[model samples]
Structure formats: C-alpha cells, structure tokens
Target: MSTGPAGHVARSTIRPHSETGVEGRKGPLRTFLSTWDGVRIDSVYEPGAVVYEESGTRSGRPGSPSGRDGLVFVVAHGFTGDADRPHVRRVARVLAGYGAVVTFSFRGHGASGGRSTVGDREVLDLAAVVDWARGLGHTRVAVVGFSMGGSVVLRYAALSRVGGGAGTGGGEVLGAGVDAVVSVSAPARWYYRGTAPMRRLHWLVTRPAGRLVGRYGLRTRIHHRDWDPVPLSPVEAVPRIAPTPLLIVHGDRDGYFPLDHPRMLAAAAGEHGELWVEPDMGHAENAAPEALLRRIGEWVVGRAG
Candidate 1:
C-alpha cells in the first residue's frame, strides 16, 4: 500500500492480495450486464448473511431487523476500480451484513468491454447494475458510490428523476432509477485541480501517455475523447435528487476536494440530503473505515424505506 495524495493510504494496482471475493451461500454470483450504450459491465452479487434465504427470498432470521428485507445496495467504485477490487469487496462484505449488494465494473474497468469516460457517461454503467438488482427481486434499492463514482451516482439519481430513466442512443434505461443514493469523497463541481492528486489525475485522464500508464500500470482503460457537452455537476444534480434520500460523506482531511465540496452539496441538498463530515479521514473508499462503512450500511437500511 502506498500513501495517497493527502494523508490516507491509497492502494494502487500494487497491493497485497486479499481474499478473492465475498461469497454468498451459493458463492459469489458473477455476470456481465450491458449498459444503455451497449458497453458490457462485469457485475457481482453478494447476499447478506441475514438478508436472503437460499431461494432468494427474505430470510426473516430470528433477530433480523425490519426494513432489511428485499433491500439491495448497488456499490459503484472509484476510477480504475472494478467489482472485484479488494477494497470494493471489503465494502460489499460490510454492506452485505445489512442487505444484498450488487457491485459492477464500469465500461472501461475490470473485465467489462469499453473505455472509461471518467464520469460523464458512466451513469449508464450504474443504471444497468441497478436494473439488474431490481430484476433479482430486490424491492428496495440503494446506490453507494466513491470518488468518480460518487459523481456518477449523483448525476444518475438526478437524471432518473428528471429524465424518467431515459438512456442515450435509443437504448431503454428501464432500471436507471434508485430508492436511495450515497456519494463519498465526491467533487461538487467538475474540472477541479485544486489539489496535487487531482492535478495528477487530470494528467492521467487527458494525456496519451497518462492513458497508457492507466492501462498498463493501473489496469484501467480510459477513453481518449472528451465530454462533448459536460454533464450536470454534482452540486447541480443534488437539488434534483430531492425526495430521494441522499447522503454525502466527506472527510475533513480529504485530499481531493476540500470540505467546500461536501458543504456545497449539503447546501444544495437542503432538507432532502444528509451529510457526514468524517474526522481525520482522507479520500474515497480506500480511506473509508470499516466502522464508517457499517454506519453507512445502517443508514441504508433505515433510509431505503
């Protein structure tokens, strides 16, 4: 593990190997899903120990709490992260304690076929996974995203409400809607180069040599084209996500966007959103502690109603 841009530890592609994945009763359910733009996404479904029975129905275990039944959490990883990333699997395992979790690789990451669009069109990748979660009989769905993914979830939720779950290129985005949304270590606006890490990240995304490094060194594929028309920023999308439970989490010591980012999102959220300013924390999922993840799981169970 290497020290992240700020204070926290950021595990690049070179980290100690962790367990293969979190396994359900029948083992990890893995598959490929197609996004609205026809990009194939690699997805994994892990059932909560207390959430689902062998038949995929609610277990109703003796001490299981209410509101957990039929609930599914769709986890969206940060840039260069895929469903199988050790950090992502750790998050899935913790969230699975409360409900089933559906995690997927965006267009250009993991085994999925396509190049990364950074954050612009990744909404389609999330939409495909959310729809798949619904198809699995989950009545309540919550989306949890980190970093770049955080931006995508915000945009996705807003688009779901405003566009009625519509997709581009004539592809029907029937499953784009979600019941709850969580954005962690996300930026409020786009094109922010306020920090060193972000500046390096921008270089990695915009330059040809950077793309090569992302592909060979980081095992992530990035698209060369830029966003034709910049999508709505996270702050702009927050107000539109109202009526749906939205949670914005940021660390006081975050390396990327400072406290202003989350604060901006909270201000936009008004009464419709909740914010958690973590103490002594750094950046995205790599820095999110297990206890915090559990608290987030609890929030999902309680709010996804």
Candidate 2:
C-alpha cells in the first residue's frame, strides 16, 4: 500500500493517470492519460487518470499493529474547488481515517484539466475514476460528493446503468458490487435552484475559454446547457440509483440548497437509502464531529445496508 499526501494509506492497485482519458504510454500529452497501465496515478489532485485502491492504515493501540483496511472512497469537490480546498481536504482526511484514500477534482476544478461542465461533463471525469478503480481489483467502491460535486456523483451512479443516464452509459459494475453513494449538499435539481450563490456563481464564471475548449472535447455542450432550467432535478435522478444503497446528506444551515431536499431524497430511498441533516453543517461543508463522520463512513462503506 502506498501513502497519499499527509500520510494517507490505501490499496495501491490503480495508478493515477497523466491525462483525463486515452490511457496509454506517456508522451508530452501524458498530462492527459496514463503512463502506467491507466490506473497508476502520477499525481493526486492534478487532472488525473488513475487511482490505486486506498485502504488507509490507522494507528491502533500503541502495541497493536493490526488495523482495519479502509474502503476505497472517491471524493468529488464542488465547482471552483480542488482536492486541496479546506473542506475537501477535511473530507478526505475524515474518509482516510475510515480506511479510505480519497481522490477527486472535477473538470475545471483543482489540477484537473478541461473546462467546467458544471456537473454534466464532470460526470465523465467521475466515470474515468470509477473505471480506474475497477482495474485495481476492488469489487465494492463508495463515492462521496459535495455541492456540485454531489450532482456529478449522483449522475455518475445513475448513468452507470445500462441506460438510465443519457450520454455514455454502461459503466463498470460489480454485477451488484460498487453499490454505495453519498451526496452532501447536492441540489435536488440543477436546472435551477433557489436564490443562492449557485446561479450567481455560474453566471459569474468566465466561460468563453471553456467554450473554446469544449469544442475539441466530446461532451462540450454540457457547459452551454448547464443552466437551461429544464433538466430533471436530482430527485428525479434518485430512482436510477435504486438497488444500490444511497445516502443523501445535507446541512440544515446550507445557503445554497434547502435542507429538506436531502430529506426528500432519503424519503424516496426508503430502505435502500438514507438522509442525514447536520444541524450546524453549512452548504457543501460538514463540520460535525466523530459522530457524523463515523456514521457516514459506515453507511457509504456498505455497513448501513
């Protein structure tokens, strides 16, 4: 097992990729694919391609060397966020403590390459991460997302179906494995949300350059159509993830989306899903102590089911 930054430990199977896709040998463009079999990662936050299984090791009782191997957790940060955002970093650390080596950086965020698709195009990036994880010999994998990242993660889990999501479908699944997901502060629907920084932030972004880049990429239109105000809300997409366990986490104090949204999703999930509202958690950030993180880890790692 290799250690991620900050002494994080995980199963060292998949490697980070150089580019966003097109895995192969390293070239000047290796910044886009994989140099080592497509799953070996070169960096953790930069636009990455592959990731190894992260089974973080924790320090047990002073004399005990035995420790639990953690679940592989993929964390997706919100728009304008990177793997290093204080909140993202904190989430990574929390998951790492539960035996997870988390990795995530949506398009246009962090060191990842490409323009922001808001959440649509970012779904492709999540797909790539999941593919790389499967290559590393893991059957059960879990995902955690925050804010816009939450949308991307939900979309990915849904799209992975043979046909639930529109674009590239038929993602790798363990026949039933890789069935857990958690979305924190995810908008029930992104076509438009209430009055908050979400819309303002999208309008505030400089997208002319993103448009230019999208022209060469496969799914460029997502950025242009992101705010169209017609797509199904996250609640609409919840049904697609059935059979696979889901957890919707929202902060009661969130300013971006309503706290009831997650509860609404949980209600829909019924026995296969759950919803947790942090009394003091804010938009895209969870500040709860060990109690919340522990339960979250258990839920997403397949223990809750």
Candidate 3:
C-alpha cells in the first residue's frame, strides 16, 4: 500500500492474480480519500471488464450493458455498516462483476473519521468518493445506497444538480454529482420511529446514553446536534432527481421503513424512476439476495453505462 500526499492510501490491487484466469483482464484499484469535511474515507475502485464473443466482438458480462467504457458503481452502506462489512462487500462483489465498483465507509462508520450526521453532511462523504471515481477515469458513475445511506444518495442526487456543496472544516466547499442512483430501504421522511428497529435506532441517535453506546459498542459516533435547518427528505429530493434515472428497491417484508416509504419515493420520482418491491425480502443490504444485487448491477449498467 502507498500513501498519497493528501494521506490517501491505495491498498490492495482490485485483482491481484491475473494468471488465475479471471474473466476480466483487470480489476479495480483500491484506495482511500478524504472528504471535504476532513474525514478520511476508506474506498475501493474496481476496473471494468471486457469479454470477447466468438464473433470477435467485445461485450460486457451478462446483465451488463455492452459497448460501454469506464462504467463505475459507487456503493454506500447503511447506518452501523462500513466499507468492509460482509454485506457491503457482497454488494460490491456483485456490482464489480458487471463493471468497476467504488465502495466506501461513510464518516463515523468503519475506518473513517467524523461523527454520523445520519443523512445530513454524509453527502460530503459520498461526493468525495464519487469525485475520486471520476478522477480514476470512470466516464459513468452510479450510486447505490442502503437505508440511511439510501436517504443520503437521494438527497445527494437532488442537491448535486443545484450546486450544493458540503462544508469542510476550513472554508472550502466540495461538490460531486452522479449520473444514476439506486436507493434501497430508504425512509421518505424523518422522525418516524414506528418499527422496533427504527425505535432502537432513534434511541441510538437521540439519547446521550445511546450516543455512548454507539460510540463504543457499535463503533459509530452520533453527532450531538440535531439537524438545525432540517435537510431535504428523500421524498422531497426525489422530484429534483428528474432526468437522472432512479431505482427504488425495497423488500415487501421490510420492518424498518415499510412499503409506503419506497412507494412514496417512487411516486415522487415520477417518470424517471422505477420501483422494485421484492417479495420475501427484509431490509437493507443484509437481506438483499445475490440475485437481487446482480439485478441491481444490471440496472445500473443499463442506465449509467
């Protein structure tokens, strides 16, 4: 691993053993980058693959869009999850099979620094990662976020179009935009502690004791201040993401946000959005089957690639 001047770290090669006969000739280059807020984010980048058919024509893997270059997917994990989490890695692996993949730790999760703003301010983290992906030569970038991260992706897409920037510790502002988006199990509005998991999550983010638990027990730091200006909600942000293709995926059995949340987001998305209410599914990345994730990868490749 080598460290850049900005304290960015490039870890493992996306694919270390080309001699092993992997389908793709190359894989993503893994690295770390800092958010505008001075938060160091752990990130990975997978290189796109090309397969040649018997007709001597080049194409991507099945479920992937053909004849595209520099296609990339930026994956965001749920609250209490990090870049290295098993579920996050699973999603990344599936997406990587289609094209390049960039997965990162949101601030206050995994090896990243800074307290969790829940959905607010986390946009900076996503923006920084997206910027890094673009810098790595990805012509098309799509973002996939789950749960709290899902909400952040929705807001990020909306805010990016309006020149919204995240606050740095210094006076500088950083802005990053994306071409496509996928939100899974995201809440439409805030402060709805209806389900048991959400009620517990509310306590984890709201109470002092809960913050302490989050800090030590969960390794997630909760920001002390509440949203003063109250950032835009997911449903509200949906309309703003017009022309940017959107896919809202939620499990029919989701206990946290319920079916109404995805429905609300889909309704707000209007013509540009598609909704997948998966049967027998539960919540977030943990419950998303590999088949479902591959389908998501296909959607991203078809739209963004």
Provide the overall lDDT of each model, using Cα atoms, as 2-decimal numbers: 0.79, 0.55, 0.76
Q: What tens-digit string does per-residue lDDT give for candidate 2 at 1-305?
A: 11112222111233343333322222222223222112322224211122223253334321111122314567877766766677676766666545434475665554555556576545556666655544433445677888887877776676564223232222333111245788888887654546666555544443655555444442322244334334335776677777767888888878777766787677766787777788877777544455676678766544511
Off by over 4 Å in 1: 1-25, 52-68, 162-176
* lDDT of each residue in 121-194, candidate 1, tens digit only: 78777767776776666778899999999999998887674235433213333344888899999999999999
Q: Over the stretch 245-293, how does candidate 3's per-residue lDDT look in tens digits? A: 8999999999998898999999999888999999999999999999999
How does model 2 fare in lDDT? 0.55
TM-score order, best first, reads 1, 3, 2
Q: Please identify model 2 stretches exceeding 4 Å from their true place.
A: 1-70, 161-177, 205-232, 286-291, 302-305
Q: Locate the minimum summed-lDDT window of 10 residues in model 2.
A: 1-10
Ranking by lDDT: 1, 3, 2
The deviation in Å at residue 301 for candidate 2 is 3.3
Q: How does candidate 2 fare on TM-score?
A: 0.67
- What is the number of backbone collisions in each predicted candidate, taken in the order shown? 0, 23, 3
